[model samples]
Target: MSSSSRASPVKWGIVVIIVSLAAYYAVYVLPRGELGQAEQWRVLQAVEYDHRASSVTAEPKLLQNAAGSDLSALGLPTGQKTSPFTWILLNSDSGDDYGPIKMLPQGQSFTISCREIDDVSAKVVIEPAVSAYLKSHCVR
Candidate 1:
């Protein structure tokens, strides 16, 4: 084989590897990173997914490790009249059942629990606004 033929495969291999890495980063990392309020929602989703699928505890710290980004400082809504969703409460449960956030008040909120039967279940009690948005976006 000529020198160019040997170099061609190596170059193609390098290109393929680069493309694969780029695709992975684009599809996985970017979407989960901090993008304002969406960051808060995605973090909650990932935590709930983890809780339902494999854990009884839903803690926010674990998200930073999984997403390759520091989401530890991500704050939840405090119902201060910023947005429609501006008053949401974030509840988490490590027991067999979710915390009683529904009875809190008129403000919106969600819970992350682990009383799920399968991985296909979602333990995150998404607010109506978030759920509706997901439905409209076809993100079921």
Candidate 2:
């Protein structure tokens, strides 16, 4: 074969290899990468409230990007009286969009500590103060 003909085959081979790699990355790696990014955005940071005085505590209330029923749980004065136990969404930096803690309940006797957890779906534990409150309040 002539030198020019031989070079043509080599160039074609390189092109084929490049195309194959591009296809492999698009088919296998691209989707997973996008999913990972989406998951990172979906990661939610929230506070689980525990009243130190009454010992009353509830689950970690997930902070939403916008205000809604979640605000009511935190006793942010959404004009909803659905539940006596009030929660508060203090601060969230898990994402760019975060809701503010609007209204703190008036005359709340118990002191609350809010902490962030890795997994929002994880089960919330009742703190020692909450346990004591439940014990005393649980009437037999």
Candidate 3:
């Protein structure tokens, strides 16, 4: 076995390792510039509201009132007469896209917390009712 041939595989392996590390950092470790703090907060709040609203059969007025107060305290205005429940479903892999769960009333906003569970899935923590609603209507 020639020294040059032996060295070739090592060099390729090192290059592959470097590229893999770079991709990992780019995809997971690096902060997403696309989602600013305010946007993230909104997404989170929306999910929480949805989860909380879903748990109870009655109207989610208390949950909505609390959420509105929280938002107001945070200096974000809650629009008038909006639904008490909001849904936000975060894509585990992508930082760019999310939508409300189907069962949630449209235009309600809640909070969401997302952590990557693996390469393919994310652990999303939302409000209790929102989570229940999602489990019933959206969980796969």
RMSD of each: 15.7, 13.0, 13.9
lDDT leader? 3
Over 19-136, each residue of candidate 3 has an lDDT whose tens digit, in order, gives 9999987776564434433444554566555454233322222222224433211111123234434433322222332332322344544332221112112322344443444345
> Model 1 over residues 1-140: C-alpha lDDT tens digits?
78855768778899999999999988776654433335444554554344332322222222233234333211222223332121122222111122222121234342322321111124334444433332342312
lDDT of 2 by residue, 1-140 (tens): 78865668778999999999999988777544644234322222112222212332343343443242222123222222232334443232122222122123433433223322323213333333333433443323
Strongest candidate by TM-score: 1
Model 3 ranges with Cα > 4 A deviation: 8-17, 20-24, 27-29, 35-45, 48-79, 83-140
Error of 2 at 60 (Å): 12
lDDT of 1: 0.35
Task: Show the colliding residue pairs in model 2.
Answer: 74-87
What would you estimate as the lDDT of candidate 3? Answer: 0.38
